[model samples]
Target chain A: MIDIQLSERQEKIIDIVKANQPITSEEIAKRLSFTRATIRPDLAILTMSGILDARPKVGYFYSGREAMSFFTNQINSMKVSDIKSLPIVVDEQTTLYDAIVTLFLEDVGSIYVTSEGFLTGVVSRKDFLKNSIGGVDLNKIPVGVIMTRMPNIVTITPEDSIIDAAVKIMEHQVDSLPVIEETVINNKHGYKVIGKISKTNIVRVFVDLCKNN
Target chain B: MIDIQLSERQEKIIDIVKANQPITSEEIAKRLSFTRATIRPDLAILTMSGILDARPKVGYFYSGREAMSFFTNQINSMKVSDIKSLPIVVDEQTTLYDAIVTLFLEDVGSIYVTSEGFLTGVVSRKDFLKNSIGGVDLNKIPVGVIMTRMPNIVTITPEDSIIDAAVKIMEHQVDSLPVIEETVINNKHGYKVIGKISKTNIVRVFVDLCKNN
Candidate 1:
C-alpha cells in the first residue's frame, strides 16, 4: 500500500470535507483564508490521492473507506515490533550534566541507562527538573543516582500489541516506554532493552492513519 | 450523546479487541497477565457500554462505529468555543526568570503575554531554552523582549472548527495556539485572548474517539 504525506493545508481540507461532505473547493478556501485559485491544486492532489471525490454538482466527499479498512487492518494486526523506534541510551557513568546535554541534543523526553548492554534504569525530563530544583552539582552526579531502577521500570515486549503500548504510556503518565525482552538469568527474569514506544510515535501512527486512509 | 469515562484497563481491553477482533476473553486475559475471571467484569462493562459486541461462538468484536460517528460529529460540528481551554496568560512586563518559573510551575509548553488585557506576544519553552543557553541575566530581561509579536502570531477564532484548530497546531509546530477574537481598539485591530487549544486537546479527542467508537 502506498503511504503519501499530506500538507497541513491539505489535511485541514480533508477535515473540512469530512465534516461537510459535498463541500465545494470555494468553501474550503474560504475557511482556510486562501484564494480559491491557490487551493485548486490541493483539491486536485487530494482527489488524485483517493482521499476525496468530486462531481459536477455533488462537490467533494471522502473517498476513503478502502483507506480506512487498510488502516484498520494494519492497526489491528500490527505488533509493537512493527512500530517501536530506537531508544536513546546512556551509560550509568554518564554525569547528570552530560545527561541534560544528551537530552537536549537528542531532543527526547527520556534516556535509558545501560550497564554492559543490559537495561538498568530510566531518566526523564521531569526527573531532571526535580533534581535541578535543589541546585545540585550536575557535573559531579552520575545519572544512575537519580534514574528509576530496574524492576520498577515499566516495560513492554515486542510480542505485545500497539494498544498495549498506548495503555502503558497513559497509565504510567510517562512520555515513552522501553520495549524490553524478558530473559531468564540464573533462573530469574531480566529484561533487555530492545526499542522504545513514545507519544510521538503514537501521534505519527494516528496522523498516518488519517493520511493513508 | 453520553461521554462515559473509561478505566485504563477497560481502554486497553478495547485496544486488544481492535487489534484482535473475535478474540476470546481467555486470550485477552492471557495477553494482559490477568485471570479470565478478573477480566470478565471489565469485558461485561465494555459490552454494556456499546463499545463492544459478542455472539455465542464468535467471542467479542468492537461495536464502535456508533462511537466513531459520535466523535466525528463532535469534531465536525464543535467550534473552538466548545473545546477551547483556558490560556495561561502573563503580563509582558514579567521578567524572563519569572516566566521560566511560571512555565515549569504551570507545566505548560507556552505562555501568553498580555499588555493591559490585550494579547501582545507569546513565549514557549524552546524560547526560554534558547535564551538560557548563554546564561543571560533572566531577571533583567522582560518577556516582551523575547516573545513572538503579533502579525506573526498564528491564532484561531472561537467560530473555527476543531479540525481547523488541529491543523493550525500541526502547521505552526507549536504545542498550543491561542484562541482570539478580533476587536476594534483605537481605530486599529487588536485581538482579545479568549482561550487556548493544545496538542493534548487533539490527542484527547482522538483517544475519546477510540473509546467512544
Candidate 2:
C-alpha cells in the first residue's frame, strides 16, 4: 500500500536521509536548519516505519538494509510468481555473437541455452569473456560449450518467497533466476520463460519497502 | 543525443514495440491492439529516430544495440563511478558467521575480505554454502578458506564504464565486481572501500529505462 499518511515534511525528511544516510541527527538538523526537537518525531515515526535507521551512539541515517526487515514483516507477502519477469531464452545453436546481441537486444544479462527442448545449459555474460573477446568466430561456435549445464542449474519455483530468490542471488551470485514451472523452457506456451527476478528488481523493492515500512 | 524530437504517440508506439519486441508488426498490432493505419506513422517516426528494429520478414521492434539503444546503451556508456555501491569491508580474522550476518545485513551479494589493507579474497554466499553448510562447526570457521584469493581475483576500476563491468560479469561469470581504487585501503575516509556494482543494480536500471524510454 502507498503511504498516503506521511506529511510532506516527513516525506522530505525521509528523502533527505535516503539521499545521504549514515549522517548524524544533529548534522541533519543543522543542515536542514530545523531544530532537533522538531525533527525528533519525524525521525521517530520514520524509524518505526523502517525508513530511518538509528543506532545507539551512532546517530541516525536512512536504512538500505531495511528491505529484508520489511519483507519479513509486511508486504501481505505475495507469491514470487505473482510478479516476476518472463525469462528470455536462446538455443544452444545460437552463435556467441548472436547471443551477445540477443542479450543486449532483449535487455537481459543472461540467456538460457537449450537443446531439443531440454534445459541443457545456461549461457550468461560471465561465460562470454574467455570465449568471445578476441575475434573468436562467434558464428562458428555454439553456445553449448560455454554454458553452465543443467542438473546443476539454480532455479526457483513461482510459489517461493521473493527473499528466497534474493538469497539465491547472493549465495549463488548469479544475476537472474529463471522462475521455473517444472521445466522452464518446455512449458506449454513456448513462453515457458515466465517470470524473472533480478537483483535490481529486489533492490527497487527494497527501496520501496524501506520508504514505507 | 537524447531522443526528444519524436511526438508523444510515436514515443508510445516505440515503447510498445520495445516491451514485446522480436515481435511482428502484426503481433505488435495485436498486443497494443492498434490498427495498421494507426501504427504506421509511429513506426515511421521511430525509424526516423533510428529507434526502429526489424527482421527480414519478422516485422518490427525497437533497436538499442548502439550507445543509444536500450539494453546496452546506458550500462555500455556508464562510467564505473556512477553505479558502484558503497563497500563493506571485513578483516581476514573475521569469523564466517559474522560475514554471514554482514552479508545479510548489508544486502550486498558479496563481501570483500581484506588482509592488512590490500585486496585479498572475496567471500560470497556460494563460499558459505561450500564451507559453512553441512558442517558441524558453523560459527568458528574463517571465511578465508572459501574465498576467491587476491591474485586470482578479477576486478574493475572505479574509472571503467558500467558496460565494462557488464562485460566482466558476462565474461567471467562472477556475481559482483569490486571497484578498485588501487589495492590500497587508505586511512582517509574518502578513499577506502569505495564501491561495488552487483548484477541486481543493472536489472533495476533496465526496468526503469524500458519503462521511460
Candidate 3:
C-alpha cells in the first residue's frame, strides 16, 4: 500500500547506498554504467524527499531509519480497522472508584461507558482527577455523573483512515477514541462501540514498522 | 516536502472528486473515456489510500479531510530543522517557584534548563507536579535539583527526521524534547540547545497543512 513512487533506477540507487553509503553521484553513475547527468534527477528527488542526505564533502548517504517514512505511508493507507485495539468498556452505573480501578488494572488511559451495548459516554484519567480533587466521594459518584457524553465525544468509524484517527486524537486532546458504528437501538439513533484508537497504538505502529524494516 | 507518490491519473481522479463528489467509478471512467476495468484499479488505489470512500449504494465520496494524510507524508519526509519551534529556556539556578510561574506564564508544557547557554536539564509539568505535591518549599528548591538532567533527557538533532522526534516523545513519555547539537563548553562535553519539539508542533503542522490544503 506504499504510495511513494520510486522508479526502479531510483530504488536501485537507494539499495546501493544502503550497501555502501557516502558514495558520490559520479560513483553511483559509474557503478550503474550511466552518466551522472542521467542519474542526477533521481538523486535530487531522493534527497529532496529526505530519503537520502548529501553532505558537501561527505557525499550522499542513506538516511538512517527510513522505516518511519514507510510507516507514514502505511498509516495513511491504513484504516482504523487495520490497527484498532479492543476497548475497555464499563457500564454507566459503575462507580467512579470502580472505574478508576478498572483503568489501572487494564492499564488504560480511558474507559468507554455503555448502556445496553450502546456507547453512552467516556471517562478518562483527567476526568477522574478532576472529580477526585473536588473531594467528591469516588465510591458514591457514578461514572455517568462526570463522563463526557456522546455527540460531544469525538469518535471515528472503522472506515476512517488511521491518519484521520491520529488527528482526531490530537485535536480532541483525548488519549483514546471509541471506534463507533451507527445503529438503531429501539428505533433511536445510537452508536455501538467496536474498537479503540489511542496514542499507544500509533506508537506501537511506529515501533513495529521500525522493527520489521 | 510530500514524499507520497500519487500518479498523474490518481491526481486527476482526486481533482474530479473534489469538484464533483459522490462520483462513481463508472462515471469517472466515462469522464476519462476509459473502460471501467481500466479505471477500476485507480479507483481502488485512491479509496484504499483514503482519498475517497465508497458507501453501500451511494457510490464514491471525498473523505472530509485528506489534509492529515498529506501532512503525515509531509512530516515523515520533513527534517526536524524544517518545523521545530524555538526553545523556551531557564537557568539551572532558577527557583522552583519561579519555574512554576514561568511554566504557566509561558503556557508551555516544559522548559529547557541551561547553564551558560548549554542545555543541562528539562522541567516538565509532571516534574513540577511531583515536586510540588511533596509539600517542599518551592521558594528554596532550585530547578536543577528537581529537573530531569541530561544523558537521561531524550533529545533530537536538527537533522533527524520529524518521525524520529515523534518516536522519542512517545518512547520517553515526555511532552517535549530539546533539539540539541553536540558541542564542547569550557573543556566539558555538552549540547547547545537550538530548538524544541513537542506534540503541539505535530498538531500545528497538521492544522497548517489542513488550512493550506
lDDT of 3 at A75: 49
Better of 1 and 2 by TM-score: 1
Q: Please give, as one word, the docking class of candidate 3.
A: incorrect
Model 2 misplacement above 4 A: A1-213, B1-74, B183-192
Please give the TM-score that candidate 2 achieves against the real structure.
0.39
Instruction: Assess every candidate by TM-score.
Output: 0.59, 0.39, 0.51
Worst 10 residues of 3 chain B by lDDT: B65-74
**Model 3: how far is B1 from its true place, Å?**
12
Worst 10 residues of 2 chain B by lDDT: B65-74
Instruction: Report the candidate with higher TM-score, 1 versus 3.
Output: 1
Model 2 in CAPRI terms: which quality? incorrect
| Cα deviation of A113, candidate 3, in Å | 3.4
Model 2: per-residue Cα lDDT at residue B61: 66
Q: Candidate 3 lDDT, tens digit per residue, B1-213?
A: 224456687778888887887878888888878887666656655665567888867678888655344335655678899989988899999998888778767767789999987898998765665455355788899999998897798999999987788778777777788899989878888799999988767555543544344
lDDT of 2 by residue, B87-178 (tens): 78898878877877787677666899887777677886556533532343546767776788876777888888766666576567677888
lDDT of 2 by residue, A1-213 (tens): 111145566768767777777777787788778987666656655664566779887767877643222123343375577668767778888887778778767866678876666556777654664354334676788898778977677777888877677767766877778777654433543223456787755655544442343
Candidates arranged by DockQ, highest first: 3, 2, 1
Q: What lDDT, from 0 to 1, does candidate 1 have? A: 0.75
Model 2 score (lDDT): 0.64
| Best candidate, TM-score | 1
Minimum summed lDDT over a 10-residue window in model 1 chain B is located at B65-74
Error of 1 at B153 (Å): 4.3
Off by over 4 Å in 1: A1-74, A129-134, A184-189, B1-75, B129-133, B151-154, B185-188
